[model samples]
Target: MLIDEAYKSRILRGEKTTTIRFGEYEAKPGSEVYLVITPSDTAVAKVRITNVERKKVKELTNQDAKKDGFKDVKELVKALNKIYGELHGEDEVTVIEFEVVEKFESGIPLKWLKGLNYRNPEEIAKLYIENNLKDSPDVDLIIRKVYSEGLKEAVRRYGPKRVRDALLKAYHKLYADGKI
Candidate 1:
């Protein structure tokens, strides 16, 4: 994921050109530089920018870059971060915890949860799907909404500890149902 020093050069003093690419990437050139976006969606596709030396990479004006004392990339990046302190701030993002309040079959909520919410949405959703997929595929419709990618995103947003705890609870439920 890091292109690093593998693609950098000062073509003409004070200006630099950096060529970047990954495996199976297309090559392109332009008045400036061409950025190629991959076509596939499910593969976490990669893109490549080739032949940058023949072109000059664009630079921001001093007035634009230094408005907040941002002299370079590091300063600009630091300034972009609005966080000072606190677990999360106004501009910061937090993982929202989702719970299953109850189960449903044929659009009717069940008392299976005993009025308690499950900490893990995936576990609850998985169980609901597994149970419903037997009688009616309609009840399992929400399963697709809870994708592996979505659950992984939740794992990334929340720490591994929380994700693992939820996963364990889900596993326990699966075990109880003899579906593990």
Candidate 2:
């Protein structure tokens, strides 16, 4: 779900719970989706869709506008017009209601390692090793073991504490270096 940067604060503060899209939107009820800020495409939070309703523009009310973080229907319409060009009252729109599940302190860059699939710590460690520590001794052997035995098995073989420490180190390094 792409949202304007202007609404980032509202979303994070729980002021905005519903979004009125110009046309049919794919978000389904009870589905979890990432809230990505537009233009930057930074993943800021995860949300669960609570409801979805389709309605004509003319049916939009002050309540709808309020849920969308607008002062009134007129304000909402104007903003919608600015985003989707001219819209008639007869035009259909989709209303998506959602609740924030998790918000990130530092948003994940969608382009970074393909968003690192929402940044699993172990996965980050594996990729970090592959990309930054490939020349280190035992790198190849560890990589092979991880691929063949999976992360849990690798953790057992290498000691859980060591694997956890490596994962934490990799995560912090990536975060500190702005690679996450």
Candidate 3:
């Protein structure tokens, strides 16, 4: 879920407990959410949904408005109208009430990744193959892990195609070098 910087800070400070969005929310109650701060694109906290309510805009009460960081129903409606543009009081909105479960550092810290010991995809593939050679060898799992986790930052920096190509090249190189 995304929020502006001001609201993100409030959520982190345990001031905001509810978020109102202009549509039906897909997340079920009890599901965890990573609140991404917009403009910065940094995930700062994790929250668990305690309740989710779908109701018309006009149905919001003062309590609901307070949970959403508004002083009262009028202010909440005004803010909603400004963001949504001409909201008919009848427009549906999803009120997601959550509790912050944990706070996270700004971004993926390079320091922690460095501790993993593998610098690139080739090293990752090499380690995976070596570790699983005596057991069940699942190259697909290594590929998936690399694509999803190891190369996440790279994918964000250089784009998916480039990162994928590089990973494939490294995997093939293992066979070429007769290391697997």
Q: How are the candidates ranked when ordered by TM-score, highest leading?
A: 2, 3, 1
lDDT of each: 0.32, 0.76, 0.67
What is candidate 2's lDDT per residue for 16-48, written digit by digit as tens?
Answer: 999989888777999988899988897788899
* Candidate that beats the other on lDDT, 1 or 3, i.e. the better one: 3
Off by over 4 Å in 2: 113-115, 118-180
Which of candidates 1 and 2 is the stronger one according to TM-score? Answer: 2
What TM-score do all the candidates reach, one by one? 0.22, 0.67, 0.60
Model 3 off-target regions past 4 Å? Answer: 107-180
Listed per candidate, the RMSD to the true structure in angstroms reads 18.5, 10.5, 9.4
Model 1: lDDT of residue 165? 47
- lDDT by residue (52-166, candidate 1, tens digit) is 2221112323433343234664443343343333221223221111111222111111121222142234555566456543323422333334434445464456644554444
Better of 1 and 2 by lDDT: 2
